[model samples]
Target chain A: MSTQLTTLLAVFLFPGGLFALVLGLSLKGLDRRVAARLQGRIGPPLAQPFFDLVKLGFKRTMVPATASQPVFLGAPLVGVVSMLVAVALVPVSGLYSPDPMLGNLIVLLYLLMVPAIVLMIAGSASTSPYGALGFSREMTLMLAYEAPIVLAVLAVALRTGMGQGGVITFSLTDIIAYQRSHGMFLLDPVMWPALAAFALFFPANLGIIPFDIPEAETEVLEGPLLEYSGPALGLFKVMSALKAVVVLSLGIALFMPLPFDGIWGLVGWLVQLAVLMEIGVTVVRLSMGRMRIDQAFGFFLKWPLLLAIASVVTVTIVA
Target chain B: MTDHTVACSYKIPVGPLHVALEEPMYFRVAVKGETIETVELNAGHVHRGVEYLATKRTLLQNMILTERICSLCSNSHPEALAMAAETIGAVEVPERAQYLRVIAGEVKRVASHLFNVGILAHLVGYEALFMHAMQVREVAQDLKEAVYGNRMDLGAHCLGGTRCDMDDEAITYMRSALDKLEPDVRELEKTYRTNGSILRRTRGIGILSHADAIACGVVGPVARASGIQYDVRTAAPYHVYDRLPVNVPVLDGCDVWSRAMIRLSEAVNSIEILRVCLDQLPEGPINDGGDPYIPPGQAIARTEAPRGELVYYLKTNDNPEPERLKWRVPSYPNWDALTFMLKEAKVADIAIIVNSIDPCISCTER
Candidate 1:
């Protein structure tokens, strides 16, 4: 009974539900403000995204007559639930470690894929032409980015598993422990390629510019979300916010987690996430334009794929 | 093994309310997989009967009416109509007024071109570049407000000459504004020229060849970008342009990148022209301000608008209102060329190609 209560508290209160949602929304708000400053304009208030979400909740969720009602309503809920579970799985260094029974790195990887898959399903179910175009583009981009991400995960798993005298370990606690004692893979030159590949995956997963082809607001009018209104749309926004925290935290745990303990460690972790969001997501997106789906596909196949493979080979030889 | 069937083609309709377009123009793009098979364009969504209204209004009233045709090239319409009316009445425009007209026209060109390029960046998915481009354009907007007393529609031109004239303070302000705008534009030019990602998206994406450009009657930077050296300012110099030397930037790359580069280079050239006009500005009355009279004659006047050559034909018969008023805007010729440029292009390249032509729907539909 006590264990059940702890699990509930961990999932809902501390790191997963409300906590991740707030942190994610705040980071998004900060990104918008900084981007506006870079462009010489005064941006929205930092809490504007929260206001937008609340406003969206009061509006009607009008489902198109052509759309599949069950799938259209269910997609955002599934996405939000998957991300909530994923967030609970990410360890906050010395502050907290997720219960091993709940999940691991592999489970988190599967959970990370839910949002994109949900978008594709929603796009198809919406029955709009833009939604269909978005569905095709989303599928193409997923096929392109998924390979590099898998190889990047493999590189990290091998680096951690070999360090601990095992063939492989899908455990997040083990990976973090190995990095804490032996120093972060971020500092290791052999793991640099995996880090580079992960950097490429970061913006693509978050739907920032350049890799934001799936939901190109200009091209397809927000594509899959065109038909989604009110609470359903707000759910999509919530899912994305939670996913940002999960993905950013996952990247931290895999690569450059600080070795501090207690509250200091958690604060350090948040600082790392903020810096990554600014540099990796905000500044880079502001500087460049979006590439075509084919251009992006070709780019992934050439650069990130090569880097991911090189990282795996170097880790196999070094470890 | 002998099954015979025809592959179905998909029709993707992009907006009367689409995200990529600023004005409402519908496009029924036929595609086989991701490649564009054929494109059918439908315009006239923002059509107002300005020409019909012109028939009812007097010549002076029509000057103001013509300005309302399109805000981007608002001054060009009135200037062209004024020149046509001046030709019929045999009115001599003051030397200083001609210089002032050139200044107003060139300033409008810089702002309009910057806006088009900024939209191109937004469509390309380079949000930072787009914002930076617009920020740079704000300097021109400030210059317009300081000199012409308005940001968008300057309302500078009148029947004989210009309605506004620059004082020493305004000239100094204009000079200083150009000084600040030049280096920022150069830096943006460097970014557009060298950025690898931008190059990947723009270069060779929307090829409008030299022959195709001429065949389609393309004008302005769209034609110049395709290696056609046809600019009305140089081809048939108007106002003070004959006295002021101009160099038109021509590129043979004939794609979206070339079109963008042409606009950037032209904007820089416009600054140079503005500098020369200010330096050679004569000392005299800005306008004739005589009794406005219309003779029984027909005359046509052409001016190099920001987009291209804008031609206005005016006919009068000893009456306050004209008999007929007609105009040939640049967007009219360029709209037909989209079909050729968009052929064999990807769905993602649709917006980029459409923007490359810089089609002004209001100007076209009008």
Candidate 2:
């Protein structure tokens, strides 16, 4: 009963529901502030995303008359829920490790895909033309990016599994513990290709510039999210913010899970998260323009896919 | 390829009120997946019947009314109207007023071109570059506010000559502003020329061929971009443009990038022209002491607006108001060419292609 209760608290309170929401929203707020400063404008306050959530909570959620009310309204809820669980699954080295019964990398990977699927379903269920375009673009982009990410994860799993004198390990705890003992994969030459591939995946998955074609604001009027307003729209924003934390923290855990233990590990992890957010997310998006849907699809197939395959082949040979 | 994936076609509305467009113009776009198969344009959302209203106002009053037709191309209307009035009246504008007239037109061209390019950056989702471009345009905006006391409508033209006189202080301010503006514009031009993000989105994206351009009668930078070496300031040589070193930059790329390059080159050229106008500004009255009487006759006049050739046809009779005032704005014919540009374009390129024409809907519909 206590184990179940602790797991519930972990999911809803500390690292997943409330904790991830605040941290994720804070990261998004920091992103906006940093982007504004880079663009030479006085951006909104650090608490802007929180204010937006509160403001959205007050506004009436308007559903398009033609929309599938159940699917359209329900999609964001699923995304938010998936992200909450995903966040709890991300282990902080020398700090909090998720209960093994909670799940592993495969579960997190499946959870990682939920937001894009939600967006696609939300788009098609809206019954608008732009939404349909959004649906197609989202599906295409996800298909293109998903393969490389899976291979990259496979490479990491094999790398950790092989190092442990086994075939493969899907457990992220084993991966983090292995890194803690064997030193960081971030410095390992064999792992560079996977790291590069994963870095490239950041913007595409986060839906920012360069790969933000599915929700290209100028093109399809933000595509799927066009019809959503009020708390419903706020839920989508919450999903995005939480997703950023899961993805970024996953990056840290996979490659360079910090050596420091206790509260210092928590502090170092967050500082690392902010640094990674600023460099990977902030600087990259500021300096790039969005790619066309076909161009983005082609780009993923050309660069990241090749890199992922290289990483996998290299790990296999080295092992 | 999978049998489960169905090849389907659908219609999407690009605007009546769309985010990409600054004006209310609708494009009924037919799409097979992501590619736009055909585009149907619906205009006149901004049809204010300004041509009819031009006849209701006196020539002097029409100067203000005509300038209000479109904000971006505001100065061109009154400048063209004043040219028509001068043609009918056979008034020789003073050299100083002529130089002043050119200065006003070129300033509007610089700000307008920067705005269009800024929007292009915006449409590509380069928000930083967009904000930077708009920030750069603020120089011209400040210059306008300083000199003409308004940002959009300069009210620069009068029947015989110019209404706005640049004193030594304004001239010095303009010269200093130009000195500051020239390098910033050059830097902007270079970024657009070399930036990978910009090139990937724009290059070979919107192909409006040279032959197609002529067939559509597209004018100004749109024509110049598609390799048609035409400019009203050069071809017709109105005002003091004949005297100024008007470098009409032409490109054969025939794409959105080329259109933007043409505008950038023109923007750089306009700054040089402004400098010359201020230097060679002859000593004379800005305009005739009062509004000169335009004789009862019909006259046609054209000037290069920021968009393209802006033509004004005016006819007067015994009444203080003109009998008729008609115009052919550059955006009018340019709208037809969108069918060709948007032919088989991706749904994403629709906004960028539409914006490349720099379509002034109010000017076109008015």
Candidate 3:
């Protein structure tokens, strides 16, 4: 196949479009089921997310009269597209790797930001009070978490780049390859702070219970998505599922992608992803309550920011 | 409407129908960047004209009508209405009937308070704790269903005394249910008291000062949470509450957490009260045999409901129906306190603060 055809196939077929959507929706279903079990209730089935998507598809997409029609309708499409491409960008260890020319870690970071940006745009464009409130909240959360993530990514880049006789490298493949050759970065004490920083970023970026202030169902009635219904809402769901796979897979690729190739690599990757989802998402959401926006803002600034800075400073010294 | 400054560009209407509120009470909140500058509460969506309905219905019929006024505080309405009518008619409630009334009130108190705290957890996004609290409340609900034959609207009170009489088997079932409820409630209380997520959201979020609490004349847990020592069961000494070991827990925190803790303590206290009611239940008649005649007169009676002090006034005429029937629910006073609580409060805290009052729209509007 030509390079462009292979890239298209990669984006639309394998690790990106259809496969990531299925994987992401199933993970969400599992998260809900496990959360229900943890709370001592019979939760929905594993196919519940898919069922919800189908239900959403059958319903009409109602747009508010006051909302900016194009912007409001367009945001979810942009979000879904970005996530599909992002899933392709993230190489799943030995099972598949993307063509480096498609873009690198820097491009992936920008794509990773599209969902939050889409939310902000969707919120603002909807012209509802709660949506505007959500826009500001998403903006604030993005600002708060953005700093640590940049520093953490830079820390990893520095650690890997210096190992390969370069000052810096924006390539995720090189980082994965470097980690593969010299053992996993997760085991190294130098990368632990960045890992911790990344760990904290997950809940906020994913908009889970503690940092879900922007879209608190009780307070804002889903904030940005309050005015959204039908297929538009389903698109947001699709974006999230793809984003979860991308983010969790990004976490693995960044710190702890196992060194097994072929089917074993895919199995190890699946197990690791499930473990991360179960421990990181389900258990944490079940255990903790939501934080007020100001408190969450302060928490990200004080702890994650400090940890990221420490990781960068240490990576500079150690590498 | 005592005082609040509304200074913001956009006014948000948080409904007669919203996710946070159990009942329909619209709040017109003005915000200055996610911080609420003022809140204008518009009530009466649940205005079923129960007060007017009460006057039209016969005294015997009003017992059933009044219970439908509010689901959570259902027992209190008829209990207070019955007390006022009994006082007006110069009818003394039988000793066994009074004990049964205490048992009914205490059981409703436990269920209602658990519900309020459970919702608080839900608003904080701690759904696990919310579900667990609800599961604990389910035990109380089962106790109500087994003993009173309804999950809500327990029609236990009559004009002269109690309508529902518990047999020995029902009493034994209640003891075991109460046993299952107590430890679960204790564990829930500990979580709310110490859990980081709950504390972070609620500890000092909604400040209803002790001075503000007194000025608002807030009753029930809202009053007790703000350090005001008032419980109608203890202060007014109605219906064997004086004889029973009723301890009112007071806190000076004057916040959402304090309100929740106050409710939990009351729920715990209610279990003890229920136990005592069962143990010392007299073996005489449960009522005056049948509905006693209520002669022409006027009287007022107060009772400490699960929320706070619930007041009812009654005036009887020659007709079968009363000439007038009115009430002052605890939520009425506690509702105004939200204006103070929402002042400069973060928008996210609005629902939590509103819920902290445990405001019942049905009773307030009726």
On residues A1-319, what C-alpha lDDT tens digit does candidate 1 reach at each position?
5777767777887788999999999999999999999887899999989999999999999999989999999999999999889999999887778888888888899899899999999998998877888888888888898999989989999999999998677888888889999999899999999999999998889888889988998877888888999999999999999999998999999998789999899899999989998998899898788888888899999999999999999999997
Clashing pairs in 2: none
Over the stretch A228-276, how does candidate 2's per-residue lDDT look in tens digits?
Answer: 9999999999999999999999999989998899999989999999999
lDDT of 1 at A122: 96
For model 1, residues B41-71, the per-residue Cα lDDT tens digits are 8887888877777888998898888888888
Report lDDT per candidate: 0.89, 0.93, 0.91
Per-residue lDDT tens digits of candidate 2, residues B199-301?
A: 9989998899999999999998999999999899989998788889999999999999999999999999999999989889999898878879888999999
DockQ of each: 0.74, 0.86, 0.90
TM-score of each: 0.97, 0.98, 0.97
Per-residue C-alpha lDDT of model 3 across residues A175-228, encoded as one tens digit per residue: 888989999999999899999999999999999988888899998989999999
With candidate 1 superimposed using the best TM-score fit, by how many Å does residue A1's alpha carbon deviate from the native?
Answer: 5.7
Question: Which stretches of candidate 3 lie above 4 Å from their native place?
Answer: B1-8
**Which residue pairs show backbone clashes in model 1?**
A288-B126, A289-B125, A289-B126, A290-B125
Winning model by lDDT? 2
